[model samples]
Target: MSIKNKVISTLALSGAVLAFSAAVSAQDATPSTMEKTEKVPKRGGHGDKHKMGGRRGMMHGIELSEAQKTQLKAIHEANKPSESAMSEMRELRMAKRAGTLTADQQTRFAAIKAERKSKHAAVKAQIDSILTADQKQQIETRKVEMKQKMQERRELRKQRKANQTETAKPVAG
Candidate 1:
């Protein structure tokens, strides 16, 4: 009933909303098989070995020249961190989820994630540098289109979940 308690509750609700939205819209590190079903020639759709897209896989319909592909692949390989580093990041995430990570571990994990993000950005920038003006437009258009598609999918999933919960109720005797 106090102002302090009301503020705490409001903060908690906002945090939950943000967390749910993030989980719903987070892009995949690797696109699933379903996403890779259709192959677009020249245009890097989903399964790009070169990692042309950023961490969120934004390189949807942007066509890449063979030379550009080679360059992007080289940049991607060079920017990749050690296997141990990635494994440690995974462990840190698990610790956080388990509510067992110490303050020091949280700091360390934040540093690791930031470093990873920077490396990803560097690779993406390298790829973007070689793209022509038209290519850049394609990338931007595809990103917007994909974002809308993702939002639609999330809405459908929520509706389906609600329906299932409703159907699970026992009928009146």
Candidate 2:
């Protein structure tokens, strides 16, 4: 082959090789066509509690009677904050986020929060009254177990982070 032909052939081969590599890299960077879409749970949403079997699940396990369930539901509904209150809370949250809450609004917001907390405590006490001693004991046991599991997860995360940091550190020559 002529020197010009050899050079042209070599250039074409290098171009093909580079194109192949680029295609592979692009494929690796992009998600696959069959990849499942991840559903991110909304923060502070009602559905979040029951997904992992929260308080309701614990109560269910305790086998509360129909009357108890009905009473609990009624208590929840009766104590539920009004739409106007929710809207006000939302507005206050927005104002707080924007750093624009006035002194009066701040005081009002704190009062609203305190009122909500009291209402929650009251509902909880009412619910406890309905629950049997055995049921409450079971619920407490579950809570303790859950707390321990959470602590274990936290320790594992810390250990993983420490391992990552150690691995990331450069070795001195």
Candidate 3:
């Protein structure tokens, strides 16, 4: 190949490799706490507790009045069905992992998951509507900071895993 052709080919190959790595990294990225909380089972079988803590913390930070807490609790209670559905989905997932779920069971479980996700979004929107613009901004800012911290923690965990894996190799004789 001519020098120019070789250069072009090298650049094209580098671009493709970069694109592939970016896609793979995106797939490997850890889910945010919010996403995990909304999807996964929490420790002690009460995943919603973390979410409730988050809400209460936000309320305290924003200095929500007693009336506001009452209103917020009402909204939360109204959204309890979605939380229950999520718990049910988690149980179904655990059953599937245990290899006891039938195909029909899996299908029903998936449908419930989808429904719960939609309802959860609706509940979030309702809650957001209750907040003032300043409160909304504070919530968004806190969320971003929390996500960044979680990502950093996940990176640390990954580094620890890598170190453990490297240490586990037996030395060659």
| Highest-lDDT candidate | 2
For model 1, the run of ten residues with the poorest summed lDDT: 46-55
Q: Which residue segments of model 3 deviate by more than 4 Å?
A: 1-51, 54-60, 82-91
**TM-score of each model, in listed order:** 0.63, 0.63, 0.60
Residue pairs in candidate 3 whose N, alpha carbon or C atoms collide under 3 angstroms: none
Given candidate 1, what's the lDDT at residue 172?
91
C-alpha lDDT values of all predictions:
0.83, 0.86, 0.80
Q: Comparing 1 and 3 by lDDT, which wins?
A: 1
Quick one: RMSD of model 3? 23.1
What's the CA error at residue 108 for candidate 3, in Å?
Answer: 1.0
Off by over 4 Å in 2: 1-57
After superposing candidate 1 on the true structure, give the runs of residues whose Cα lies further than 4 Å from its correct spot. Answer: 1-57
- Which scores greater on lDDT, model 2 or model 3? 2
Residue-wise C-alpha lDDT for candidate 3, range 59-147, written one tens digit per residue = 54775657766778888787777566668778888999999999898899989878878988987788777788888888788888888
The number of clashing residue pairs in model 3 is: 0
